[model samples]
Target: MPNPSTPEFAVVCRFQGLFPKDIGGYEKHRTRNGGDLGHVDPTRSHLNRPVIGKADWAARTIALIEDMKAENFADEIETLTRRRRKKQIKERMAEGPRDPWRATRHGPMREVILTANRDWFDALPTAAAREARAQAFEDAARDWLLENFGGDVVHARADLDEQAFHIHAVIVPKVQVELNGTKRWMLQPSKHELIKDYEAAQDSVGAHFAPLGLKRGERRAEAVRKARQAGEEPPAYRQHVRTADWRKAEDTRIVETRAELDRRTEAVTAEEVALEQKQEAVTGREKAIGAREDAAMAKEKEAGAVLAVGQGLAAGALDIEDRDGTPALIETPEAKSGLLSKLRARMARSSSGRARALHVFSKALARLREKARDEAKTAVARDTAEIQSADETIVEIASRLPYAERRSIGKIRVSLSARIMALTGRDTSRKTPAKGEDDESP
Candidate 1:
């Protein structure tokens, strides 16, 4: 059988700073837990300490760290410190080959590793910072691997050991490394030589740190600006650069939205106030209408009372129609009693005509009716005689009434004059002097 082709891999290195031993609790904690967890807490006593160079040997090397396996695993130090081995070797061992040609490590055993200085570790903010630093290291490490190792590289896992944050990556080689016209062994690189080559590659790409710290949106905008500057189509990395223009646009949008919200709020407030005022106005109008209706009802009641009082006096005149639509005769019981009492008085006073009280009353009413007719004629004559004086007064007073009321009064006055003429058996045409006769020069 031919020697198996070597698995392509990248290596990473990391470091952490240490304080002097006289620090009391710090040293003890460091010794107890190993330095994987940095010295952020003093009371906790044990900050995790990391082990060195466990990238390849992490499965077995975990037991050799400062704490027991359970405590170390409890803190997830293995996950944090282990480098990604792109392929699972144990899984390969599990599946017994059905066909001898198909069983080869060349297919999937990709792996990579990374290393960094203690300054980088201290530069991290907190646990979150540590995570970000790890990710950055992976990304940088992968890029280096692809550029130098000539295969697509992806980080599979990470582990922290002693001072270094290390990663394991998988590589799917596009073109195999040619060693004097033969495939080189993938997993056979000398450990010392691998570290040296990895360091040299990492030093070549140092500018990505600040950009990595930026927010994703900022990174994208920076990429756009760079693309514009270069006068070329934006590269895929443009999506990673954060720039100021995007943030400025976002701020402008926020400010505009706030202003619009304030303006709408003001408009809504104004509308509410206006609606309240309208409601108040409607309430006032309703109250005024109610008052007018109340006054009209009161007037009707007073008129009814007055009609009860004077109705008897005008009873004999019942046969007559007044200017208003009401009859002169008393229509109510109170008015009837009054008319009968007056009739009795007239009968008591007249000796010979005692029994003819009704006739007397009839005669009196007839005379009074005639006199009223004459008086009405004279009143009309007087008004006609002084037409110039009355005209303005009538017009002004009539104008004060509504048009319908004014028309009603005119109709009543005309009907009354016509009725009086018919009762007196007089010709209406000749009863009154002509209009200009009162003003004649004769």
Candidate 2:
């Protein structure tokens, strides 16, 4: 026996074909006049509850077919009609009526019942709560019918007197027709499009009620297959429908699984974003450090160039009194031994030896002069290149420096001058003789 506290889960969507002969019998059952009180339980039925919410037994079914045709097949209707005269001499002609209802042989209407397991209602604590739930389910079922089935829903009612609260809706299966540029509608008797596949319909109904904690029952084929796999005797009932309680539990599990997956996905996405941000920050810091290092290296090179120039001047290998403030290489001690020194050395020799020595010394003096001139030019060129390189480095550093740092360029120049003076042991701040000016002894 099922527990009273536990709700049974079952979403039932069953369709019954309504032929011309079956309409009267179905109407009688809907009206509760056929003596089928099996659905009614006096102990369970709520007081003052209406048995049927809607009814329309006197509705003209044939007129509904004609109206559908007139609306959808106006052009085809004219083609099917013929002109007729009341008398041979009468001038008036009237169009004969077209009858499309004669063709329907099978399904004139469809009865769809939407219900849930009895245990679902039994689990509800109060009669009012059960009534509300049943009403909501009925409304949803009616909406589903109108959305999926393109037909006339003539009647709909909720049967609270039944074993389980259920909705019964009557639908006329009609299709729109277009012929000769005119719209027409016709009733489909052979095939009801909505309930063509019973299994597919059940699946759809299950999905519709899944949010409400009601799911489809198991299929007969699946139950048979499972029974064969288990090597057990098949149950008498081919279908293995789950109870309302079981369906509700399964739905809860599915919902929780989906929620967990979504949370994990969100977490992974957030982590990726954070990682990208961290990488970008690291890259920015590295670039900043690289720029600072480059500036420091350039300053070091500039200082080295200044120190080299100062060393050359202190060694007397270069003079710093040039017009453009650039250092110039001076004559070395070796270059001072020119033609005059050679002639003086040769003067003490015998006439023939002196003449021969003079000739050799003259050639040697010429080569020495040429070599000295080339050496002075090379040294000047090298010093000029080094100075220009240092100047370019300073300019580049200044351009890359921030606005606040750029203001220190003048201070940097002053520092460079002080460094040069300190290395050369010169007091450059004291007054000194200008280029080409003589220094008077006081």
Cα RMSD for candidate 1? 28.5
Per-residue lDDT for 84-201 in model 1, tens only?
3224333433542222112333222233434555555556569887777766766665555556544233223444534555544443222223332333222222222332343343
Worst 10 residues of 1 by lDDT: 14-23
Per-candidate local distance difference test: 0.44, 0.59
Model 2, runs deviating above 4 Å: 1-8, 35-62, 66-106, 178-184, 189-193, 220-442
The per-residue C-alpha lDDT of model 2 at residue 90 equals 32
Tens-place lDDT per residue, model 2, 1-442, is 5457655597988766565455666666556565344546656444313222234432555466657645544454444453322352132124333444445533556677788887786667997888778777876787777666744666666777656777777776666656545455655543454467677777788888776777786776567678989998876764322233345667789899999999999999999999999998999999999999987765555444444333433444323233353323343343334533443343333344333433444455457778999997787667656754675566566666665565576356446656755654557586432222222211
Clashes of each: 48, 11
- Runs of candidate 1 with Cα error greater than 4 angstroms are 1-251, 312-442
Candidate 1 global CA lDDT score = 0.44
